[model samples]
Target: MTAPNPSTHDQAARLVEAVNEALTPATSYRDASLLPAVGPTPPVPQPGRPPMSQRATDASALMLTAGLATAPPGLIAIGLLVASGYADPLVIGMICAAPAVIAVPVLAVARLLRGAQGIGAEHHHHYNGPVSQHTVHTETKTRGLFAKTINKQ
Candidate 1:
């Protein structure tokens, strides 16, 4: 997919031009727009990334916030479970979600607190752009262990 060579880039650019040329006929476009009954003028299409990135960031922040707020519920559940006579719903939920509960304080004190600093900016009047960096998180599962890293060369 990486067209490093000049010849391939020229070909790709030519192909796009050809496709765009074929898509619009002067008469066809003019005829459609000539109708005075149409509503306000249509907005122009701008070239850039779609708005999905903002939405994705919002969703991630929301999920993480929800997870951080449920710190004490998990601890209480585990405590009640261990003190129960035989069986209980609280105990079962506690056992299943124990890991998540234990991680709440760490998540708040470390990651949440760190990320909060970036949320505010009096100097950033125009745009607070994304900070790009290359990183990798490796994990070992039943399938196997893997080292995932970015190679930008």
Candidate 2:
């Protein structure tokens, strides 16, 4: 077997040294002192009021569920009656109009009750200290499944 070339031996030695340098654990400090000091804890957030009252939300949910539960069967019954020539035009018209007839007065009464409860009415605030007021307005635009919110200060 021929002796290994001097240049090839030197190259192998340099490659081994490079690999050892890479594999060796670093000696530099990796303690918390190398990181930023922790600052004071942030203030807890306050809770906001819901868009609708519990009673109203419950009532609306109940109405929606009742409508969903009854509508399909009711429609099928009406269709069968009309097909069998047993349904009168006036009765059919009244049945179709029932939702509007029931909804109008209910909505009006709800609006009046909401007004009595002072919701959406402006209030006068009296501040007794040096006050700094910062107002933020947010607008949301939604199209299909995507929504984007923009904030103006």
Candidate 3:
């Protein structure tokens, strides 16, 4: 069977419906204060690391990018010359094309690395990072089938 072809408005409406469903809280969970407290919160201690210097990072990145940019041209030249000795056009064509094809990804990666390096890794407090011993005490409503069997045994 062919897939249903939804119009742009239909797609948008479906998306809105899904968003509304997600935003609306469950009736049971509407009053969170009604639930009993679970055990004490788990401790999440931050691991300390020696701070890195931005100058050192930038220098290394510059050196790496320079090396990447030069390596491909040198390899392509050498590879074609070596492959030409085999007297195979197919081998020579493949060898010539391989470096050119790989060059795009290499440059993209170098650009990405440069951009990331430019945004110096200063410690920012990310939301999903370790939460201080704050417990959102909510208990599971039902036990697992295995859990019920285990308790009986």
Best by lDDT: 2
TM-score of 3: 0.24
Candidate 3 per-residue lDDT, tens place, 39-145, comes to 57775666753345888778878998998999788777777777678546676678669978999999999999877845557857667766775535555556666
Q: Each model's C-alpha lDDT?
A: 0.72, 0.85, 0.74
Q: Distance from true position, residue 73, model 1, in Å?
A: 0.7
**lDDT tens string, model 1, 1-153?**
864999988999999999998887766433455656778888576786444578897887899999987868866766776678565867577677887988888888898677775644555435468766656665534343665544434
Candidate 2 lDDT tens digits, 103-151: 9999999999877855457878899999998876665665676656556
Ranking by TM-score: 2, 3, 1
Candidate 1 regions with alpha-carbon error over 4 angstroms: 1-52, 84-153
Instruction: List the pairs of residues colliding in candidate 2.
Output: none
State residue 17's C-alpha deviation in candidate 2, in Å: 26
RMSD of 1: 25.6
Ranking by lDDT: 2, 3, 1
Query: TM-score for all predictions?
Result: 0.23, 0.33, 0.24
**Which pairs of residues clash in candidate 1, taking residues 3 or more apart in a chain or in different chains?**
none
Q: What lDDT would candidate 3 get against the real structure?
A: 0.74
Pairing residues by index, what is the TM-score of model 1?
0.23
